[model samples]
Target: MKVPARQALQMYCAHLREQAAGRASNGELDLVNERAGLAKAQRERIEMQNAVTRGELAPVTLIEEVLSKAGGKIAGILEGIPGAVKRRVPALSGDEIKNIGAEIARVRNIVASMSLADLRDSGAESDEDRGAGSDEVIDA
Candidate 1:
């Protein structure tokens, strides 16, 4: 039977407490406390997995916000280039300016095609790969 996350955790904690209290010899409570913590962690992990599967949880895109702010800064830099040319900066060649414009267009095309969900999925894959690496290190 499927029980709610909070209820399942609460029931497990109560059961653990009761069992521990019954078996305690005045100072053997640490082991029971550790068991309860482990159980709580497992329950919370399952709840998080369920919530993710049900689409009840979503990642907040602070990275997307930062990218937007960086885009604005890039635009300002691009705009300032024309002023630099006006001031006759010998370092700024026409071909170099054209290359910069082309690169910015390429970046825009790439960013426009990628949605937040796509980014999140890729991020999840990266996280999994990182976790797998850690597991390998531990096994070694």
Candidate 2:
């Protein structure tokens, strides 16, 4: 890799000779690399400590728990849509509300059932839209 640059330098000195440019032993190079790695790790540790002191970083478990709770709240709100519809639209009959609930459940299941693993294992499944003989009703 250094050959091109070294060749270009020959134009400046005709009598110049090349010598061993590497360490006497692999152990010497390894020691230098180890010290460089130690310095990098120390810097990383200091950065993490500084972030924690500034309250910019949180534990992974705490973050996961907060996100999970928020997702649960959203799911609960989505599950209540049918009841809200029934309350607001009193003209809709019981069967119509049941059908709405069934449609909501189908959508919820479609969202909840999808995963990276499921996609990798069997690809994506096609879903039929509402009023396609889907009679299962889920009570919120």
Candidate 3:
């Protein structure tokens, strides 16, 4: 049975949403795994310090190895989904791409100027921080 084009597109979008949900779940799992690994590494470091006090293997190399392996696993888990979604979106025209690039740069500059104090403050900076300068238009 042939589905209508709109229905097919709706099904495709639903599938993408499911995939995105899965990716989000995977991301959360990765974060939890990272946190567990971090706690484990901290514990190992403490233990290594104790071992050093008691005269053990030169220094603690195991913590570094654990951290590296955890980092690699987390990075691999996070990298797969964005590319799949990007493949589904249409490419922007040259002018549109340039506008996006400019807006991104402008936002980056604004973010760069923000200090930790500014971030923590209830009402930080003024209209100035809210893209007061630069004429980078962002079209949705």
lDDT (CA) for every model shown? 0.68, 0.73, 0.64
RMSD of each: 18.0, 10.5, 29.1
Clashes counted in candidate 1 amount to 0
Give me the runs in candidate 3 sitting further than 4 Å from their true place: 1-91, 131-140
What's the residue-level lDDT of 44 in candidate 1? Answer: 100
Top model number, TM-score:
2
Per-residue lDDT for 4-28 in model 2, tens only?
8777778535433211322223534
lDDT of 1 by residue, 1-140 (tens): 99999999999898778676754433655666677889999999999999989988766686568888997787677656655664676687777676656655655555557676977777455443344423235544
Ten contiguous residues minimizing lDDT sum, candidate 1 = 127-136
Give lDDT tens digits, candidate 3, residues 11-95.
Answer: 9898778656543345346545566789999999999899888877563488668866885665554454344434555474556
TM-score of each: 0.29, 0.53, 0.28
Candidate 2 wrongly placed segments (more than 4 Å): 1-29, 93-140
In terms of lDDT, the best-performing candidate is 2
Identify the runs in model 1 with alpha carbons over 4 angstroms from their true place.
1-74, 78-89, 121-140
Candidate 1: residue pairs that collide: none
